[model samples]
Target: MNKQTRPLLTLDQLWQFSLQYYSAREIKEACLHLQNHFHGNVNLLLTLKWLDEAQLTFAPQDWSTLTHSLTHIDALLRDYRDLRRKLKAQVSDALYKETLHFELQLEKQQQTALVNCINTLELNPCETPQLVEQYCLQLGAERLARIFIQPVQAHYHTP
Candidate 1:
């Protein structure tokens, strides 16, 4: 389908897509690697995956707007994630699980904000690897980019 004919992506759809992929071990590892080593935004990376699935591509200005709009929330997520990691070993398993739940809520909030921003933007119709590559290169994480783009093994494909 062409750009005009393509359906707009919703928050629920994006969230479901994220949940499915994030549950995969390889995708989780790749996302965390990007986050830990390259300061990449997992929400955005997952959004990229969603967009690619939908055959949608963002324009340069759209990327700028989305990233700029998410900066504050992303900063909060980063801080909380760091704290969560630090507490993992120190806290009781139940407490750590609670922290993990809270972090997931924060991630959902970020995704909500992302969908709102996306609704106001103009998107193109094309293969999205170039866009993903551009984003990965900007993060200086070419190796992680390959992980994102490559197809996972069949067993790992199940969400």
Candidate 2:
């Protein structure tokens, strides 16, 4: 039998950490900027950074749920993104602005669902050495350029 792979933090655990860290206005701003402005995968970015915080190793297969990654919320995000773009031209419309705000709330709910989906897995604690590099590699060079905010360095690196 093939040995099944394990992940560092369960979806729920990862989400909990995300909520805690992102609760800070600055961190949340940075994550949102990377997600909105750059093409970086926000969930992966948040999860990867969280794993690094706990000093855990990166198990590639652990991300098997990657397929399920944004599937649940892709549509909502797409809609929100589209509306956000449209709102740029109609920024003065109160109704349009309110709609954007509603879409943003829906987007947040979708993210919450995404993080809650794979909550069963346990966090595999270890001394993760090159996880930051791995995350950077996954993010790719172009996206990383915008996503890699200065203070973000303190969060994603090995100790």
Candidate 3:
């Protein structure tokens, strides 16, 4: 609804543009055009353009599919997280002699699970701009930062 929340591109569209145009320049230009119209600022014109020309573009039909796909993915991720937490809660979960190795294995499992979750959402053309806009609204900038940063802080001590 708002200018800042527009979905300029979809995942599949991005891929197609990349394949057909051989670069994302045109898409980037479109984003910059939108930006100029909305904010009248040229500072982030290029970056906005690149984001606009990403490897995928969203579509109307893709919204339901994306919702379904993301729902399933979220469920699986939640289940995996619960399972890991339960495992950790078990006093006898790890072999006493293999504590070091077990910790390593758990860390690797968490990392692998996270990567898998991200990979599951790989950009596709079917994504709809409306869906992206909706997601952005739902998450907001600060929450988005937490979504990415919380995991890293919990596992990697990233500041």
Candidate 4:
């Protein structure tokens, strides 16, 4: 209800930004690399990127809340992902293709839920663009290079 509790970014905008960004061939390639090799969540990486683009900031408590909200849902996604891979291995072509479509939809559902949850959290945009990268890096580790074609490069020195 309050600013602190409501989402700072619109879910639709976040989804659109992520979708557009990920559609790029190079970005997709990099994200798949991280996802397949490092078990990175492409959606989360995109979400972090979106925040950086928006020049937004989040608190540690916000990260804790996000983790709590996403943990079970993320596990479900992992289960479905494993099942889908197994199905692909065991099933015939037509069946595998059909199941693949379902799996893709399931992934979108997860992304939607993620963006919606993020929208519920209150955040503040950076007063200066130079701080944008600093804010985004707090959300996760320095794996952006693995997931982004061009890792966001906003460098600022703190005195």
Best by TM-score: 1
Off by over 4 Å in 3: 1-55, 89-134, 140-159
Model 4, position 101, has a per-residue lDDT of 81
> TM-score of model 3 relative to the true fold?
0.30
Off by over 4 Å in 2: 1-38, 91-93, 129-132, 142-159
Error of 4 at 56 (Å): 1.0
lDDT score at residue 29, model 3, on the 0-100 scale: 53
Candidate 3: Cα lDDT at 149: 20
lDDT per residue as tens, model 3, 1-159 = 355653443444333433333223543353344333442112122212223334344344543443443343344444544555556656474543355455434434333333233333434553222332333334343322222222112322225
- The runs of at least 3 residues in candidate 1 whose Cα sits more than 4 Å from the true structure, single-residue gaps closed, are 1-7, 151-159
Q: Write the per-residue lDDT of candidate 4 for residues 130-156, one digit (tens) a residue.
A: 222332345353555533424343221
Against the reference, the lDDT scores of all candidates come to: 0.80, 0.58, 0.36, 0.64
Residue 17 of model 2, lDDT score: 67
Candidate ordering by TM-score (highest first): 1, 4, 2, 3
* Candidate 3: residue 103 Cα off by (Å): 15
Residue 55 alpha-carbon offset, candidate 2, angstroms: 2.5
How far in Å is the alpha carbon of 146 misplaced in model 4?
7.1
* Clash pairs for candidate 1: none
